[model samples]
Target: MKTTIFTFHPDLKNGSRINASLAKAASEASFEVRDVYRLYPDFKIDVTAEQTVLEASDRIVLQFPIYWYQTPALLKQWFDAVLEYGWAYGSTGNALRGKEVLLVASFGAGAEDYQLDGRFHTTVEEVLKPIATIQYHTGLLFLEPFITTGTLNLSDEGLNEQVEKYLNILSAE
Candidate 1:
């Protein structure tokens, strides 16, 4: 199956460490990776182009670092713009039906901090619930997310291991 990854990092080429590495690995493995921020610096997404790519791919992976406990601004914009009424969610919107969406997120805090009584008082899955709910509206199958916690202190070896895990998921049927 054809899998396409949309990476949403505002400073992926510079500031990001984990996200950059992940994208690099995916690209090296011959996956179609689109750097969304770099593609639309002005935040003017080409809905037609994005929808075309999504339609062609069997799996759509959204890779990004969790910022403020949510996705970056541009990603939200992409969702609002690309997932239109008639094409993504209305009664006639079935263009994305049967497609699978996987969210790969990196969190600065450790996994321990995302529990019921943890620092954030919430789980990683809980934090991602809003985004996952997209499936109910669009018919896109929501896959269990791949999350890497404690990104702020992840070692090179750990990052490499995470990359391997991410690639394995992508390679899975």
Candidate 2:
């Protein structure tokens, strides 16, 4: 199956260490990795091209570092521009049906920090609900997410573990 991982890191080169490694693993493995920030720095997304990519892939993976409890601005912009109502959704929009959607996100805080009594005061599920909602809207199958917590200070082993896990998640049937 063709899997496409849309990686949206604003500072992919200079930011978090995890995002880039994940991209590299997927890219070197010959999986499709769409670097959104690098592809559309001006926030101009080619809806047709994006739709083509999505249509061709059996699974769509959205990878990014959680920013302000949400995906980066460009990712949001890509959803707005590319996931059009009449195309990705709506009664006539069944192009993506039977496909799978996966979320592979990174969090700066520890996993505990996302619990009900933690600093963020919300569950990881709560923080990631919108992506599932998108899956619903698109008539796509929603898979469990591959999330890594405490990205601010992950050891080399921990980071590699995440990269391998992410690769596995996307690679699975």
Candidate 3:
């Protein structure tokens, strides 16, 4: 199956560690990894091109680091611009149906900090509900997300371990 991972990081080359490593692993494995921020610094997404990429792929992966409990600004813009009503979710839209959508995200805080009684007072599922809703509306099959928390201080080995898991998940049926 053809798979594509859309990576959204504002400054991936310099500002990120774990996310960059993840992208590199996917790329090295021969997966199509689109560094969205690098491609569209102005946030002007080419809807046709993006939709084409999505349509051609059997699996679509959205890779990013959580910011303020949400996706980066450019990713949000891509969703708004590329996921059009008539093509993605309207009555006549079914292009994304049967496709698998996966989320690969990282969090600055530890997993323990996302529990109900913890610092964030929420679960990862709750934090990512909006993305799930998008899949529901678009008829895409939502796969369980791959998330690594406590990204602020992950060791090289720890990050590589997570990357291996990510590669495994994306490779699975």
Candidate 4:
């Protein structure tokens, strides 16, 4: 599949220990990764170019470090700007129909911290409901999301293992 990943980390250079590695692994594969912050530093989005990539892609991956349980500011702006009324949804919008949408997110909190009785008091799935809605409303196929939690304490070996699994997830049918 032709995959396009929209990576939304503003401090990628400083904070991409895990995500940056993943992006590197996918760099020459069947994927194209876009750094949203780098692309739109001025917050001026090119909706046409954005939509064009989305339309050409067979799979769409929104890769980011979940910020306060949501995407970073620039990606949010991209969504609001690119996913317009007559393109992504509404009467004449069918741009994303039959395509696939996925999210590959990294979280600072551990897995146990994202549950009903955990620190956040909600499952990661619960926190990700809005993205599910985007899939449902857009008539796109929703693949299982890739999530990495507790980034701070993972050893190099552990991190590489996770990256390997991530490659598998991307290659899986």
Q: Which residue window of length 10 is worst by lDDT in model 3?
A: 128-137
Superpose all Cα atoms of candidate 1 onto the true structure and report the RMSD in Å to 1 decimal: 0.7
Q: How well does candidate 2 match the true structure in TM-score terms? A: 0.97
* Model 2 per-residue lDDT tens digits across residues 43-83: 98988999999999999889988988988998889889888
Query: Where does candidate 2 have its weakest 10-residue lDDT segment?
Result: 164-173
Instruction: Give each model's clash number.
Output: 0, 0, 0, 0
What's the TM-score of each model vs. the native?
0.98, 0.97, 0.98, 0.95
Give lDDT tens digits, candidate 3, residues 37-127: 9999999899999999999999999999999999999999999999999899989988999999899889999999999999989989898
Give candidate 1's error at residue 3 in angstroms: 0.3
User: In angstroms, how far off is 166's CA in candidate 1?
Assistant: 0.7
Candidate 4: list runs displaced more than 4 Å: none
User: What lDDT would each prediction earn against the true structure?
Assistant: 0.95, 0.88, 0.92, 0.85
lDDT of 3 at 29: 91
Among the numbered candidates, top TM-score falls to 1
Report the C-alpha lDDT of model 4 over 1-173, residue by residue, as the tens digit.
78888888887778878888888787756568898888889999989999999999988988888879887888778878998888998888989999988888888889999989998898899877887888756788888889898987878997899889888877866
* TM-score-better candidate, 2 vs 3: 3
Those runs of model 3 whose alpha carbons end farther than 4 Å from true positions after fitting are: none
Q: How many residue pairs of model 3 clash at the backbone?
A: 0
**1-173: candidate 1 lDDT, tens digit per residue:** 99999999999989778999999999999999999999999999999999999999999999998988899999999999999999998999999999999999999999999999999999899889999999999999999899999999999999999999999999998
